[model samples]
Target chain A: MEDTVEQPKAHGPHGYSARKDDHVKRLRRIEGQIRGLQRMVEQDEYCIDILTQVSASTKALQSFALSLLEEHLRHCVADAVEHGGPEADDKVAEATAAIARLLRS
Target chain B: MEDTVEQPKAHGPHGYSARKDDHVKRLRRIEGQIRGLQRMVEQDEYCIDILTQVSASTKALQSFALSLLEEHLRHCVADAVEHGGPEADDKVAEATAAIARLLRS
Candidate 1:
């Protein structure tokens, strides 16, 4: 906790920083889809219809994830690999774990 | 559009009508999570942390879909099967299609 308490700024920006606005826009749209699902439920819409929306929202979230993952590989992982050290391995491993989680979900 | 415009009341209500409040509540929570993700991106939170949250949100969406699907099977599909007609086949096929879409998404 002591050493990790540095600060977000200490790392400059994250891999996603370059596409921050795009990410935020995509998230806001996903939020709208969630709200739409709530409305469909409240209105007693057809079950299959609601499920379809769920699928769309899930896809959108995954798409956003893919974008973030690409940026991560391009910037963070690439940078780490360039440095040629133990941290490079950790970065790639961390990214792999995140991909595994996404796939399982 | 003609047949579909018959009104939602024509079908009574969907299978999820039984747990309307629960579904709405879950959706609202998911919506909150999406907003949190947006904030994370805006704040330049770590890429890994954002990806982790995306996985959580995606998982939650899928969970909601599963719940809706279960109710659809227990109620709508069951009713159609009990009636013993072509509609039963249609219901089963529709559900299968929905599941496939979810998988691909």
Candidate 2:
């Protein structure tokens, strides 16, 4: 089991450092907000107030997803298009499917 | 604008360190996996093969969420239950709503 524990891997060269860092930072903030929400509930805050926080947290997550999607389009999709082949088509289709999933969410 | 950049906050004592660390680690792995999936598509891999990787990436995300949900129930919900009040009920309700959102996703 100890041997199975994987080391943290670095992002590839093509990885967008600025956007990825922003996403991780935002997520950590969201994680803290979630913990705060739990505390509010455990302290017996008003139901409406708790629900409001839930909405905020959900919106934060959605915002993160949108930012990530935009970054993907600008970087990954653009690269595929420049290459210009079946790969480009595949990249577009994959991105479309991802957007569809986000919409459903 | 630079002054507005918030410093990274530390998790509270109530935060489950082991589980949170595991979750973050898993998510980083998923991030890498997502990048890989994009590359696969951009390289013009077979449609079916790209789809398979997409399925795997999605499953990894689901696994991360499930782990997070379990940790929340064990720590946050259990804490609320121990307190025993309207807060406990709110906590449970919040958790239920979260689970519903996850199911929809």
Candidate 3:
């Protein structure tokens, strides 16, 4: 099957756009896990057990963010750097801020 | 309104059991945030914007875990310590392990 990204009008397709389906699937699974945590809470599962699940959910989220960041650096940031302009610095700084947010969160 | 925890079978009501509704509400909101991320990906939203949202969701999950942990310390661990037995040490050890999991995750 063709892996060409279906471009959106607002801007060029993102690095992740090619693997959109895979990303969506990963997110949906994380969503399900969150819902399962809700069910466990409703059932009054042990507190430690619920905490374990919460940790797992958080890890899943961080993993997703890391994957997206990788693609952003490989495509968007790299493209900007290749052009050798002030925008390249801006892109690098912007990416750094995003990483800070992830770390703090 | 009566805040008396509705005890569950198999064991006494857990520390967070009294705030079960609150915990469930938080989980549901986090779940919604995850779905929102999926939509952002589907629509090809900027990766930075999506990353921001992911950080927010992760923060929310951590907040929920911290709240639950506070309650566990106030009730479950406190109760175990009051009894002054080997079980109290076990509870503290178990809680520490759970916290470690959260950190590593």
Candidate 4:
């Protein structure tokens, strides 16, 4: 087994562990951008203005996706492998295909 | 600074740490499924078969996404917040919007 670093146990009612404060923070900003986009569309903002923001949004999303992908590759997958079997292989495959689809989109 | 556990600084040319071996295994299975889908399409498999696979693929993708999302909420995002500032918030927001978009898809 690989070296294990015990993370702080975060208490929460959401089934999964408590999310990072930074994650929540990032989410809030994204929400603002989304709202801004909506306003732009409603106000008939310039195509360039809307598109520029859209592009920004897309890139931001891609970055976020990349970060999450990295973590999955490092943690959950690692844990699954350490534990063993065909199920792990199926899971990794499922994840990769999903990633390919995301990249395509 | 929070509790830091030094993970095996896996040696690799890949800028990021070496991915969990399990991730590769999952990816391989997903790849096989993709190939199977392609073959099925080439042979003009039944719509239901394709659709069923498509649905399965989508669910699989979503599951993968969820797993990644959980990790992000735990690690990178946690680190960012601990470090401090607006950049962290921005990143978290960016990630959140992307997730919302993904869930919608």
Candidate topping TM-score: 3
lDDT of each residue in A1-105, candidate 4, tens digit only: 222355434212221223446556766787888899999999999999999999888777776555555445434544444455765555455655666567457
- In model 3, where do residues sit more than 4 Å from their true spots? A1-12, B1-12
Model 4 chain B worst lDDT run, 10 consecutive residues:
B8-17
Computed on alpha carbons, the lDDT of every model, listed in order, comes to 0.88, 0.57, 0.88, 0.59
Of candidate 2 chain B, the 10-residue stretch with the lowest lDDT total is: B1-10
- Model 3 over residues B1-105: C-alpha lDDT tens digits? 223456452225778876888988988889889999999998989999999999999999999999999888888999899998999999999999999998987
Model 4 TM-score is 0.43
Using TM-score as the yardstick, the better of models 1 and 4 is: 1
Preferred candidate (lDDT higher): 1 or 4? 1
Candidate 1 residue runs with Cα over 4 Å from true position: A1-12, B1-12
Off by over 4 Å in 2: A1-105, B1-15
lDDT per residue (tens digit) for residues B1-105 in model 4: 112355334323221224446455666767777888899999999989998887777766666556555445444554444454775555455655665477447
Evaluated against the true structure, the overall lDDT of model 4 is: 0.59
lDDT tens readout by residue for model 1, A1-105: 112445453244777775687888889899999999998888878899999999999999999999999989988899899898999999999999999999999
Interface DockQ per candidate: 0.56, 0.04, 0.69, 0.04
Judged by DockQ cut-offs, the docking class of candidate 2 is incorrect
TM-score of each: 0.89, 0.46, 0.91, 0.43
Number of the candidate with higher DockQ, 2 or 3? 3
